[model samples]
Target: MANSLVSIQILPKTKNGENVIPYVDEAINVIHQSGLTYQVNPLETTIEGELGQIFSIITEMNERMIEMGSSNVISQIKVLYQPSGITMAELTEKYR
Candidate 1:
């Protein structure tokens, strides 16, 4: 089983700054619709679920942001695998 988590930060340069919100909203909707749980913050969101679903949501979010005319919008996504819940040690094992 793949229990993964991801964090995304989107930065867009445009007059429609708020337009990015809908893209995130839609992503959350997809997660919710799929019966997964997630936490969202301004310009940042963390989702926990199967790896495929997590990536799928991020991809969809990117498409929506592009469709909304977000210029140079960049996404920073972090992925984690929770073997026994999340821990700093696991993070270090992956990155270090």
Candidate 2:
């Protein structure tokens, strides 16, 4: 079981005031390549994994945004860590 759940919303400033969707999609692609369990919501993406790995993924996302011509990147992150282990499904199961 994973020890952390991280939700991240990345806002990347476009260099030419272009649409940001492409940048966001690239950031999400970084997450997809990580092979970790994740859920993509409208405003943010939630990733479940070790805390360190999640943070590393966030770093990669930012780097990717910059590589994609973002002048600046803002990441809003929320973390839920349980050493005993937790999962998104476990947390939201009741609602489902």
Candidate 3:
């Protein structure tokens, strides 16, 4: 079961100062491929999974940016961990 929620905003330094939306899309793709529960927000994408898996996904996302020709990548990350268990639905249920 998922025990953590991680939100991240990845800012990849594009070559020649180009637009980064494509790169952001690439990062999101990585999250999608993980098959974990995820929500794409305007500023950041939130993912729900085990802490270790979430961390590995984050690493892959950053590496993907580098492979995509980004000179450098900056990631803003936030995490919420509950040893018992947690889910995005549980956290946002009231709002929904």
TM per candidate: 0.63, 0.98, 0.98
After superposition, which runs of candidate 2 have C-alpha atoms over 4 Å from their true positions? none
Better of 1 and 2 by TM-score: 2
User: Candidate 1, 14: how far from true, in Å?
Assistant: 2.7
Q: Could you tell which candidate, 1 or 3, scores higher by TM-score?
A: 3
Off by over 4 Å in 3: none
Cα lDDT tens digits, model 2, 1-96, are: 999999999999998789999998889899999999999999999999999999999999999898888889999999999999999999999999
lDDT of each: 0.67, 0.95, 0.97
How would you encode candidate 1's per-residue C-alpha lDDT over 40-64 as one tens digit per residue? 7776777767778778877776676
RMSD, model 1, all Cα superposed?
5.6
The TM-score of predicted model 3 comes to 0.98
The residue pairs that clash in candidate 3, if any, are: none
